[model samples]
Each structure stands twice: as structure tokens, then as C-alpha cells.
Target: MLRTDYKPQSIRQSGQLLQRHSSRGFRWAFTGTIIGILLVILSFNSGSLADSHASQLSTEKNKISAEPAQQQLSADKAKASIKKLPRMNIELPPDTDGRLSQDQTDIADEYENAFPRRALPLSIETSLYDESADDENPNTLTAVTVQAGDSLARIFQKQSIPARDLQNIMSLGKPVKALTKMMPGTVIEFVRDRQNTLIQIRYPLDETDTLIIDKKASGYHSKIDQVKVETELVSVNGVINDSLFLSGKAAGLSDNLIMQLAGIFGWDIDFVLDIRKGDRFTVVYEKRYAAGEFLGNGAIVAAEFVNQGKSFRAVQFVDDKGNRNYFTPEGYSMRKAFLRAPLNFLYVSSGFKRKRFHPILKRVKAHRGIDYRAPKGTPVYAAGDGKVIRSGYNKYNGNYVFIKHGEKYVTKYLHFSRRKVRTGQRVKQGQTIGYVGMTGLAEAPHLHYEFLVNGVHRNPRTVKLPQARPIDKKHRTLFTASTRSLIARLDLEDRIYLAQLDRINRQQAALSNSEISPKSAPQ
Candidate 1:
């Protein structure tokens, strides 16, 4: 409420303050109005600048309008050049069903995506064979060498071949069973048609036979085809300065060939005892081939072994009855009724003697048999075709086998670890009757072999062995006619070898003489 006592000075000051606030408000409103007007003018100028920029953009658009036509002309010229290019008309191989498989379709889709503008008919023939191959096997083949630890199923899986086809091939039973036993490094060829479908397979069974599996309308059919093998005559000769094996190896003879050589002359010469230095041998043999590739060494047509200054030659003859045997130039058989040594031995521990000191008994005793010292488990062969009379064990003789050869001769093998024949089994010559062992009353592994003639012990090494029958009288003429050239070739090869040796010796002697001769004194 208003009272008379209120101070008028305070009221006047309040009025002055109100006046000042009113003036400040007016000044702020004037400043805001000026700023608004400036903003409007700037906005108007920005609109004019935008209009000028729009007009410049319209003129640039008009200038670029002719570039589209020029670009169109260039594109037309490019199209014309593309049309003028040589069109390669490639014809893809037709499929059997006149359609692509799902896999082929997917591959084709990938090719199309890779080249979207124009996808050329891309064909990759998987065959590594020449296109000019014969019609019998016109389909290209991919060869794979079987690696170690790889099975046929694994190989087929690795090649992406259908398991059903492998099953069908195996269904052939006997013919394709050998495929499961393929050795490492065996080459298997797969022939696929244009569709990459397995059409044929070729697996070589041996040097001459190849197993071929062809996919037919019914199923896979398998067969073995043999190549024609040709036999070529070859000769090898060696002089024995050391052992026969070493000399033969030095002369480039394989182990098999060397063993064959030993077998041919083994009846007459004791390879363990009789082979001496200065001995020589000549072998005329056959080397087989199929399709220009060497197969292996074949039968020995003729051979000569000179032992202890005596020359022995044998020529092979196949009779009319298909029986093959080695015969001398005089038609005498090379085989005897009994082998000179029943087994391949390293050395003789004890010879047949009237009296000798026994290692086990430690006393002088009659050593009726020859003790052949060989490694334990060495095979002991039957000396001849004979029936076992006794096969038993004794304290003195370990595992013993006694065989009766006809009515006159008996052979006994002792100190064997085991016996192969029973009491009545007939054994052939060179048949392994038992292995060597010292089972009883012995110190080391050895075979004690004894020869009995008419119930009396004889020296097996020096005994007169019964002679084998000569070539049959009926085939004698045929044998002579067939083996004449072989003997001649053998002799000729020997003479040529001797001549070469003589020439070499002469050259060596001449060199030695020249070396030893005094050089001409310089004047």
C-alpha cells in the first residue's frame, strides 16, 4: 500500500533505472534488425551466384552433348572392327548323350562367369597321347605310376574315377585280380572319352602281357593281351682271375645268369673246391625283347667251361617230345645220377677220413662223412631222387635223414635243425630235404653228409657217380642238326675272345718294351 512516508528519491531512481533498461532494449532491437538486413542481403547475393553457376552448368552440358555423339561414332567403329575380325568357328566334341553332365555344366558356368562378354568354347583334352593314335586305342590316355603304399581303390579315388567302375572292373574276378597286387612304379593308363568318362584302362601284368579293361554297353570287360617276344642271340665270356661270381659280375653277368652258368657245369666241377685260377667260360644265350624293349636273359643255348686245363662244352637241345636237356658235342648228357655236392657249401670242415679228431667227442674217430661248414639254416638238398629210409634224431647226429637211392646207394644227411621228408617220402635231386643245424653232439652249425655204396661208406667227393642216359637215339640226329650252329657260334666267340686278349697282351707288351727301352741320347 502507498504511504505518505515513502521516499520520493528512491522512486525517482527507480524511474531512471526503468528508462535506462528501455533504452538498452531499443539499442539491442536496432542492432538485431541491422544484422537481419545484412543476412537477407547476403542470402540474395548467394541466390544470384547460384543462378550464375546453374547457367555455367547448362553451357557445359551443351558442350558435352557433342562428346556422346563422338563416343557413339567411336563405339560404332569398334563394333565394325570387331565384326571384321576372323570368327573362329570351333566345334566342340559331341557328347555321347548329346548333353553335358552336371559337373560339366558347372565347369561351363564358371567359364562363362570368367568371360562375361563372350565365352569361347573352352575345351581341354585331358589325354596326353598323340591325336593321331590308332583307332584301336584312339581315346587319349592318362598314365599314373603306382607309388608305394597306394592301393587300386586309392589310386582310382585320387584320379576322380567312379568307384562303381572300379567295382565293375573287379567283378571281372580272375582277369583283374592282379591289378590289386600292382607293384610300385607300375604304370596304369586310363582312357577317357570326350566327356572325361573312364572308357578304358590298361595295366601291364608282366613284360609281355597287359591287362586291358574296356567299358562296354553291358559292363567293363577285361582281357589280357600278350605282345610278341623276339629272341636275340648274345654271347658273354670271362676269364676267372678270382672267384667265378666276381669274374662273372666283372663280365656284366647278372646273378641269375651266373647261377645258371654254375648249374650247367656244376655236375662235373665242384664249384666249392674245384674252381681254380686261369679258368675261363663262354656263354651263348638268348636275350628276349618285346616292342623293342629288352625283357631279360633267356635260355642258355650253349656254354663252355674250361676247368683245370680241360675244356667242357654243352649245347642245349629240345627234343621232339618237348624235353629239354644240355648235351655235349658228342650227345652225352650233362646231368649225372647224383650231384657231386648235395648242397651249396662255403667250405669243408672235415673230409671223409679213416681217422680224425672229433671236436665234440675230443677223440680220434672215423670221419665217414664230409662235414660241410655253412651258415646255420643253409638248405641241404637231396643228393638224388630217392626214398627216405629214416628220418630221426640221435645224440651224435642231430636231425638226420637217410635216403635209399635204388638198391645200391644210400645217402645220409646229419646235424640238421629240421627234416622236410618223412620216413617214406621220395625226394628229387636238389630238393631241400633239411636245413643245417648243430642240434646234438656238436659245437657249431654244419651238415654232416655221408655217402654209402652197397652198405659201405665211401668218399662222396671221389666216388664214381652213375652216368645219366645220353640223348635218345631217335632224337640224336635232330639234336646234332639243331645244336651244330650253337656249338660253332660258341667256338667262334671263344676264338674271338682269345684273339682280343692276345691283341691286348701284345699291346701291353709293346708298351712295356717301349717304356723299358733306353731313350735316344740327345746329341
Candidate 2:
């Protein structure tokens, strides 16, 4: 089937269709090219627009900042001009409107009402005002507490007082000597004039006495002024269960008061060895006061101590010679010639035994003295007022001291670490003669004490001591009359104490019975 005649016509139609497809492709390509060019132009225009907008904003911001900068410059210039103006202390007169005058002209008239004026420094104002006031009124008093290491001269210099004034005060001699020895916490007052000259000085010596030194026409004069003090009797009592110190403290007795009590009855009873469990004591002492304020304790008026079922009472009395002493109701003195023990001891380590084993010697020997166990360096006192006959150290006795009282009595002390007395030195009763130690022939720290009469050693514990001089016969009636009320008061206080103690004991027993009855009940 060769069809040559229809081939040309069909070919012409195909070629025309091809030419039309080519023209459509070219149109599509041209349209795409135009859209791409337009998109690029739009992007460039948007970028330029954003840049212009940002430049406008920045220009506005710069202009805004320039306004405040110019304002600040002008304000600074105004301040500089104000500072350059002259200052004067000229005061302004008040107007017809009843306004107050001001010392400064730069401030407005209404400135005082609107704002407060700045105050000057405290130190400057104080100096100026105080100077003026002192000139007007010359008298002024300055008080100072005496600090440690502060001398009178230093204190005076600190207060601007003249040295000549101190010399004048010191010229008064013994009356002003206390000022030189001023203790800490003492308050001293100085009176001065406008010229910084000292006029007077006041120092309180105690609660009731004050030493006042004043500048008079005759140099300086000093006088002690005493305040009237009222005496009050305070009674206190306590029973011992542990020790005198602890029981006295529990009864509200101060240490000084307890020691005073011990000293009053120390002649008859040894506090360390003679104290019992049920011993009781009552004391009436004087408390001094001024204007209803307590000053301090004065003296013990009367006291009673009951030991081991025996009661001892003493009352303080002043003799005609102005010597104060404690005496019994029978007009007898409470003091004795010799003390039972020469020193305060812990316990009796070794008694006076004719046949006893010695710790160091390891054999039975005659121990003529009592060994009193005590701490090292414990004070050893003289048993009676006597002269030291021998104070020396030996191989067996160690450091020893011998005191001879009159012609018949002699006391010996051995085993001392330190000797306080010398040979031929007179020592008072209760005076410290030596300190205890563990010397030669001693196993531990102890005091070996021996009492001799006519060269014969006697047991110090059982030896009878001599009584002191009694009250004078002329004052016997007065002593009895003055002491009777005190003794009766002591009896009354004892009865009251016994009653209270019985009541407490009954209450304790009842409580114990109640507690035990519940446990012992039958179930």
C-alpha cells in the first residue's frame, strides 16, 4: 500500500502543527523571564524602602537627644554662674508684713517656710555654744569613772584641769591620800570655773563617807563628810547536813559571814574536826543603812552554836577601854590561850602512839607528835602568842619551828616546805609560821605537831587549854544586863527552828508511808 498522493498533504499539516507548538513554547519562556525580572525589581524596592525608614527613625532619635543635651549645657552654665557670685554675711531687714529677718541674702524670703536649713556639724556647734555658756555661768561639774591604769594626773589632763590644781589638792596630805589610791569603778567629780580652773573635787570613800576638797583662800582644804547610818539586826539560822560552808551558803549566809562565825567560836571548837551532822547555828548581825538603802554588814551582835548536844552562846560587848570582845552570859571571855590545833588539816594521818609502825622506817617506834594530813603548802599557824626559839631544818625533822610560850609551854612544828618565822621572832596566836610539805622522814604532805609542858610531850588533842582573861568585875552587872536579851532571843529562834524541822520531818514521813502503802497492798 504505497499512497504517495496523500503523503504531501499530511506532511504539510504535521509541519504546521509543529510550528504552532514551537510558538507556544517561546511564549511560555518569555512570560517566565518577565515574572522573574519583576520579582527581582520588587525585592530591590522593598530593601530600599526599609533603609529609608530606618534612616528617618535615627534622624528623629538624634534630634530628640540634641534637645536634652542643650538643656543640660544651659543648666550647667547657670550653676557655674551661681557659684561665682560673692558671699556675704549681710542680714536682711524684715518687711512691713511681719516677716522674720534672715542672715543670708541668697535664700528666698519664703525659703524658711518651704524647706529646712542645713545644720552645722555637731562638734562645731557644741564647741561654740558650750564656750558661750561657760563664760556666762562659771561653775560646771564633770564626772569620770576611774578606769584601770588611770592616774589622777592623766584624768586631770583629759579634763583640761591644770597641774597646779592637782598639786594644791595633794598638799592637803593624808586626807587626800585616798585619791592617789583610787580603785577601779570609783567615780570622781571635778568642779571647774570658766577659766578651766579647778574649784573643788569630790571623792566618795565609802557608802557613808565622802571626802570633799575645796579651794579656799588658804590654799586647799579637805574634809570628810559622813552620812547618818541606821543599824538593823538581821537574824539567820541553819542546821548542818553536809559541811559548815555548804550549809551556811544554803541558809543564805555570805562567805564573810560564815568565816566570822567560825572565828567567833574557833577557840572552843575546831571547825574541821569538831563539826557533827546535826550541829546548828544562829546569828544576829548588824546591817547598816542610809536613807533606807542597805550599805553593808557591820558586826555580829550575838551568836549561838549547838554542837553534839552542847550549846555555846556569845555576845559582843565593848569594854570601857573601847576594846570589843565576845563574852558569855557569866561575864567570861570566849577566847582561850592556846588553840586545839595549830593548822587547818584534812584528817589525822597518824596519832601519837608509843608503839606504831613507821612507813619509812618499817619498824615500831615512839611517835610523840600527831601527823596532820593536809595539802602541800597549807598554812601552819602558831598555837599561842609566843617567841620563836628555834626555826631550822634537820635531817630527820626537816624544816621545823619551835615556839616557846612564857616559861612552861612549848610547841614544835615539823615537815614544812617553807618557813615564815625566824629564830627569836615574836609571833601572835593564829599567825602563819610555816607551810606543810613532804620533807625528810615524811611519806606525804603532812604537819607533825607536838605540844610540850616542862619538857614532857603531851597529846595536843586532850591537853587542857588555859582560859583567857574574863570581863572586868566592875562591868559584870552591865554585861549580864546587856547579854540577857540576846540569849533569850537565841533561845526563841532555836525553838522556832526545831518546830519547823519537826513539821517537815512529819510531812516527809507521811509522804513515804503513802508511797509504800500502795506497793505493799494485798492483791
Candidate 3:
């Protein structure tokens, strides 16, 4: 500055230096301003982020501190509730292997020891008798009387013997056949071993007796011996009210026995039509027993049926020829040539008459046959076995059938709605001939029945009937034995009924005495 020299080259150089310095300073200033603005914006944003982070950390600390207190309160409540409950005791059942407990094992042992045991006792007398006897053992024999209806198998079962023993004993054909047919009231002896096993079974064959061995393996055998027994006679009485079947049951009679009684008196009495109220029957027969046990009832050896004040008695007798026949006391055959009626309950709507007023014609006419009143379409049967002679319709008889029985018997059925048989046809007894109807000159449904002997008309209701064939001579002896046993059973039944009646009477008498005593007491 002191030397102020003014030169063109120096001036130009100075201005250039001033311009370069100013340019450099302006560039530095602009760069510094931009960096400061960036720093300020970054500082403001970083401060906001730090504040938010601190607030989040404080909330997390508060949550961590409060969680433990809530959990402790929940745990305390749970413990208090747990303390308020009651305790329990439980019992379990014992195991199946019997190792559960001492008490259980002891109870099981006691149950096993409680059952009873039995031992077989040998008889000393049997041994003594066997040693003293020669080839035969002498011992007391017990006999069992065979009751009526007792079968071999049944008796063995009742005595508690194994049925296999019966089969072994029956292997001997002759002994089994003889014993199987034994009649009720017969005596059978059974010999048993010490073990209660049957040793021998003995029964009668005919006049000769037989025995059977019980043990097949030992080849044991039976001995035959003869013994006699006695039986008693008994009577049974019955009265009829509703039907013959019921009356027989009321009197302790079986259906088969009642039917036999009905058949015995079927000839003289028409059970279908002639049976009346208060008809009483009494049968006297034998009662048979083996060892005081009841057997089955036998035949009606003698019977009486009192009907309508008339008494009919029949006695079964075996003649010299060994033929059995039912006859009256005076030896009259209890049989007739024709039965009174085929049906048991038919009614006589019209009777046999010479002159009778006809219902259809309204005039007196000859009515030769008996008209039986029955339901419409009631079956009309052939009274006996015969051949049909005529079966057709006629003017007076709408439908008719005429049957000829042998040479002396002829029967006619008229006024039928329809015919069942044809002419020249064979018919059996009780075969349906036609049906009842109001046909021809009849006023109602009925069967006009007629019986003729050699073409002469007779009364059908009072006609005699034929008898059934008697038992053969060959079976007579067996029949008598069997019948006697059955009769004995019937007798026992009668005694039982009498005993029941006595008991009833005693009860009634006691009741009557009690009632009278109460009335006579001073009140």
C-alpha cells in the first residue's frame, strides 16, 4: 500500500484473486447451511422417538409389577375353597383270585368246608349170612307191591335208581317181557347191594315166577319164588246233573271209566234221550295195591245205573269157556237187537200214531214214524250198519234214505233237506244219512225215523239194540288179572272219596257247634 504502483498486469491479477477467493467462500457457506438444516431436523425426530420409547418401557414395568399380585389373590381364593370340602372313604370288592384280604380268604374257605359228605355203610349181617349159607344167601327180603298204573321204568325212577340199570336188566328178553306186562297190585322184590345198587329184580310170569340180575358185568342171576296176596272190594257212587261226563268227574271217575259205564248200559238205556236228572250210578269193583300205594282203577265188575226210578244192574262174569259177558243177575243178555236212538239228545217232536193231525195238510192222517225235532241241517245217522235200499226225493218225503240191516232189520229216514248217501250203498253205524229240514209235508226241521221188522213198522225209541263182541278166550285170563288190578284202583279211589267226605262233615259239624254255642250264650 505504501508503494502504490499502478500497473495493468498487477491490477488484473488482484481482481482475479479477489474473484477466486469470493467464489470459494460462497461454496463453503452454502454446504455448511445445508448440513446444519439436516442436523436440526434429525435431532427433533430422534427426541420424539426417545420419549415414546421411555413411555412404553414405563407401561411394561407397571404391567409386570401388577401381574404377580393378581395371581397371588387367585391362588389364595383357590386354597380357601379347597379347605371347605369334605373327605371321603371308599371300599372296593375283593378280587376273583381269592387273595384280596384275610377276611375274604377265610370266608371262601368256610364256604368250601360247609358242604356235607356221606359214606357207604357195609352191613355185617349180610356178610354173616353169606358165610353161614350154602350156595344161597339168607337175608331179610323187602317186597314192594306194585300199585296200579305202575310201570317198570316209573318204579325204578321213583326208587331213585339210574335208568341205565333198567336197560341192563331188560337186556334179558324173556325176563323183560314177563316183567314189563306185570299187572298193578302185583308184588315185585328188589335186592340191593350195600351201595344201594339193584342186585336183582323179581316178578311173576305165570304159575312160575322169574328173577332178573341187575349187574350185567358180573353175570348175576335172579331166583323164582311164588307168593300169594289178597285184595279188597270197594264201591263208588255218583250222581248226574249237567252231563254224564261231569257227573263221573265229580264222583272221582276217569273219562275212560265213565265211557265204559255208559257203554255197558248203552243197550237198555238211551243215553242220548233217556238220561234224566238225579240219575245215580254205583260201581263195585276190586281195589288192588302192592305196598299200600294206590294203583289204577280196574273194570266195572258190577255196576248199577238208577234212571227215572228204574234200576239197571249188570255183573261182568267169566263163563266156563273163559268168555266175558255183561249180564243181569238172572243171566239175561244186557243186549238187544236195535238201539233206541242213534243221537243222545234228540227230541221226539212227533210220535208214532195211526191217525194224527198233519200240520201242513191240516187234516188227520196216518203218521207211522217218529219225528225227531233237531236244528235245521242236523245230521241224521244210520241207526245200525246196513245197506242203503233207497235214497231219493219223493212227493211226501222231500229227501229220504232207507237202509236194510241184515234180513230182519230195516230203517227209514224221511223229510230230509238233502241226502248224503246213494241207493245200494253200504253204510256203517252212525253214518250220516241226511240232514233235517222242513221238506215234503213237514212243518219244521226234523228227522222222521222209522224201524221196521220184515217191513212192519215199530217204535224206534223203545227198540232193543245189539251187543258188541265179547273178549276172546285166549285173552280171558290176562283180562281178568288186568281188570282185577284196575278194579282195585277204583276201590282205593272210592275210599279216598269217603275219607274226603268224612273230613268235610267234621268241619261242618264243628262250625255248626260253634255257631249254636255263640247264640245260646247269656248276653
User: By the TM-score metric, which is better: model 1 or model 2?
Assistant: 2
Write one digit per residue (lDDT tens) for candidate 2, span 303-363: 9999998998889998677888898767778878888888878889998888899888899
| TM-score leaderboard ranking | 2, 1, 3
Residue-wise C-alpha lDDT for candidate 1, range 350-404, written one tens digit per residue: 8999999988678998999898998899999998899999999988787999999
Cα lDDT for residue 126, model 3?
Answer: 65
**TM, every model:** 0.61, 0.64, 0.41
As a whole number from 0 to 100, the lDDT of residue 387 in candidate 3 is 95
Ranking by lDDT: 1, 2, 3
Model with the higher TM-score, candidate 2 or 3 = 2
Q: List the residue pairs that clash in candidate 1.
A: none
Worst 10 residues of 1 by lDDT: 114-123
Name the regions of candidate 1 deviating beyond 4 angstroms. Answer: 1-205, 210-224, 498-523
> What's the lDDT for residue 440 in model 1?
81
Candidate 2 TM-score to native: 0.64
* Residue 468 miss distance in model 1 (angstroms): 2.1
